[model samples]
Target: MLGERVKKLTKLMLTGLTMALCVVAFSPTVKAEAAMLQESEPNDNPAQANQLPLNTWVKGKMDDEYDYDVDWYQFTIPKRGVSQIEMIPDSTNTSGAGWEVSVQDVNRHEMLQISGRTAESYKLGLAPGKYYMKVSGIHQTFVDNTHPYNLRINYSESEEWEIEQYYENKNFSNANNILPNKKYTGNMYSERDVDYYRVKINGKQ
Candidate 1:
């Protein structure tokens, strides 16, 4: 009889210890999982805080001419940021001697001149507000081919970099201020009624 009683007492103590361990293992007060969940909330909308100001773009087409000046390409940014400008040739179009891009700061009277091939781009980081991209056709007028050119201008602070590229020909040197291998696929021309390059403002994230 004493042996049986001892066995029963030992079983009861083991059962009690097991229950105590289970309670400690799954305690409600020590919620490690819930604490971890709270940590993920802060970074959810980190990009929303860096939103860039609104921007507009204007596009224009140039016909065969020695100096097809585009003085009307202008706009104002509500805030200062980066500007990406491209003088792309219409995919369905062709150029005889290619086009040239230039800029003149309204206040400083400074000028930047760059020549572009069939699909080339020029990017500039400038202060906010009014600026101009004075585009014209290059004069290899000796070539008897009709040239039609297109332009694209994008402005944004959220973009990774302000860059330009060209790929119509196989020239791969950075001599023309062109960023190598940055390919672009978009509407080459924005209709005849469109008279200026298009600008886009990217949101910060």
Candidate 2:
């Protein structure tokens, strides 16, 4: 009877040890899976603005943490130039809310604001200095975390060649006349229009 009781006790100990080992092996995997389901949050205010460089594009997202989420970006133009700022939302963003973009000078003065449901862009002649761009959802309704946007900045130093209206040169065959190494400005009234230019190259190297 004593030997039988000892065997039963040993079997119980072994069973408990096996169950503990299984728990230890699978706990980390369970925790890891839980972590993978969580989404990352972006910087919300101007104080955590992301720094951007000229002629570069960045990706940003909106989250549900706040009623209004604003993303800030800063860039510096080394010389007096024309700057083109563009913001395009992802097609997967089915949220009916639109977005707003605002540009500000280094002194915190608002320079320009663009708002609409579609992709938006702004071209302006800015002085050589630092500028900040603020992006937010319109009417505080943008809360889709899965969708992101693309922001780009393009700048070119002010050139001697100036053409205010190049509407007729919408195609390569009807390219606007221009001088080489000169900057020109033209109006892009609509999204369907393209501005084409023909530059005269004087000599070959």
Candidate 3:
């Protein structure tokens, strides 16, 4: 009887553990890890652009049919975070004249761009929104399927120290409420970009 009881207890314990693991596995706390991905065809335009995950490598090929052929990839972040996009071409065209990368907004407005056979850019204040990464040949006649490329992008969920990324407090009326003892961050993506903040104090010495 004791041996049978022990067997039953063991089964119950194993069942409970499995249930707990299932909960954790389906939990929403999971984050994307660095992984390899392949680009799907028909991703030549923003409308048909491939959905890219954060901190992952995606292999793709640019059209050799025309120099204007572009590969567009779309990605999103849960919140404001610093991100960098790196591009590497599998060819001997090491000069910056061969290819280019444009990080653009949902409307296809270029934010930051890098021109090179291979390159990457890093920065903060990348607003929380849908963005696109575009890669294409600058002006090379000798480009085609033989020249594939690898692209990777990733982002953090932290506001920059002393810099504001989705700075909605750009004006006095829409100023951001800040803390007295805490530091903030700001970044101006363009000349027109500005930052504003407001803090209240109480109890004077």
Candidate 4:
């Protein structure tokens, strides 16, 4: 009788321990869901711009139930250079609807806007400072809250160099030789003007 009692006690203890472990493992999932629900609200202004990290993609949604819903993201340029901003919609909903992605300065002045369901990137020279990005539905009645989109920002340092016009080397045969990994800025003197540049590669890049 004691042996049977011991076996039953051991089985009961093991079952209770397994249940406790399951609860601990699943608790984080419940908390994450709650956090996402909280983040889905009140993101519609520059003042409430969600701070985003550079070069990282973030997911967001636009609620169709709301007439006007905009998601704002804020990022800072470490230094003056060319920054690329990408807005890509969910692949499943690309054919169904569209969204408008716009970039604005810190003062809320519009800089650029692109509208479509396809992925697009904007390369612009920006000063080292903070900027705001807004993403909204193209049409108020057609927005789909079930679909999610992504946003990313990348920056590359600018190299300053000058290229004078009317140089002796104007043709491809006499192309003005340039060094690798350099940025050159020049202007076209007339509408019927062309500039040729060549770079010598020593080996496989």
Candidate 5:
């Protein structure tokens, strides 16, 4: 009788230990999978969805050459999902005269020029590609005072990012080359003439 009782106790103890281990090992996996599912889900609001893990972006007034800014005469847009664009003229209201925005392909060829508020932003409805933005302030009456006009671009892909001023000037260029991909070329806009400006290769090739 004693031998039988001892054998029964040992088996019960072994079963209990095994069950405890299984519970601990599987618990972590279940939690991790749930978190991942939440992240993968798509939100109807593009602006809200792009708030996850912050990525590198460009902004601020065109300073010296390579220096970028965070806010102020500044606008924010996502490099990914950008369906809207806003123009903030300096106190001088440079935009009151007129403003133009444009986009270019990788090869620096002019893809499109948008005049008026209707064309401020474009929804391509395609995957991410190498592109740049150009802005021009057109004024009928010449404002002798130099005003700092801010450009704001909003893109929506996975996030809503903005690119203000990417100064591809001297100082930060190698052998007279302003960061091959980040340099943009644009001339002061004119009322009768189409203003030419290029988006610094803000994104990769």
Candidate 6:
């Protein structure tokens, strides 16, 4: 009788342990948000821009209005990915000139630009390289230094994701040189949007 009781107790303990593990395994988990980063000084140009993280909030301020302070931030992607940039400005503002924010290439070529009130957003599709995020007081008119602005950047890594050709690629002006044994991904934006791709070979024929 004691042997049977001991066997039952062992089985009960095992069952209870299994049930506890199941509860823990199926428990809900909250994802931690990225940390907030402060904008550094002397980031007026891309050469001296602050390092921007992939997914983080950067608080910026135009400290010297007389100097026409320009805050520039730079970020680099290891692989092909899309970056979502959100520029949040002070809503309760009376200034006509808010801020001119842009993402530029290494050569200072503007990839995209955003200028408006509240939270302005832009989605950028880029290959692996260094990019710049410029928040400048260098404007035609005066920029609002009284109201501080916030910038948040989020990147979607797609090194393994295949470039889905959902829509037909009609344009081939910007030819893409793809590498072998590697996956490439690009956004077609929407159903109405189009994509372009090309493979060039320089073999002696």
lDDT of each: 0.44, 0.65, 0.71, 0.67, 0.38, 0.67
Quality of model 6 by C-alpha lDDT: 0.67
Worst 10 residues of 3 by lDDT: 160-169
Residue-level lDDT of model 6, residues 75-185, one tens digit each, is 887776667778766444445546678877777756666775444555556657888888865355444455567787788876443233223333565445576656666
Alpha-carbon runs more than 4 Å astray in model 6: 1-35, 90-97, 138-145, 159-174, 177-195, 199-205
What order do you get sorting by TM-score, best first?
Answer: 3, 6, 4, 2, 1, 5
Clashing residue pair totals per candidate (backbone < 3 A) = 9, 1, 7, 0, 16, 0
Highest-lDDT candidate = 3
1-205 per-residue lDDT for model 4 (tens digits): 9999999999999999999999988886655332221134577887888887777777777765553778888888776466667777655554355678887777675555677765565566555678889988777435445556777777766643223233333567765567888766544433554667788889887
In order, what is each prediction's RMSD in angstroms? 22.4, 14.0, 6.6, 11.4, 16.9, 10.0
Which of the two candidates, 2 or 3, achieves a greater TM-score against the reference?
3
Quote the lDDT for 173 in model 1. 38
For model 2, how does the per-residue alpha-carbon lDDT over 61-129 read when each residue is reduced to its tens digit? 666445356778878878755777776765566766567888777667665677766665667655567
Give lDDT tens digits, candidate 5, residues 1-205. Answer: 9999999999999999999999987886655422211122222222222222222222212222222211211123335343444444445344233446555434444444555422454433211455445544444422433334444445445322222222232122221223444533332222332322323466577
Candidate 2 accuracy as TM-score: 0.53
| Candidate 1, poorest ten consecutive residues by summed lDDT | 35-44
Residue 159, model 5: lDDT of: 26
Per-residue lDDT for 1-205 in model 3, tens only?
9999999999999999999999889988976675568788787888988999888888876655556668889988668557777888745433333568888877666667777667877465566788888888777634344457788786777644333443333467766567888866655666656777778999887
Better of 2 and 6 by TM-score: 6
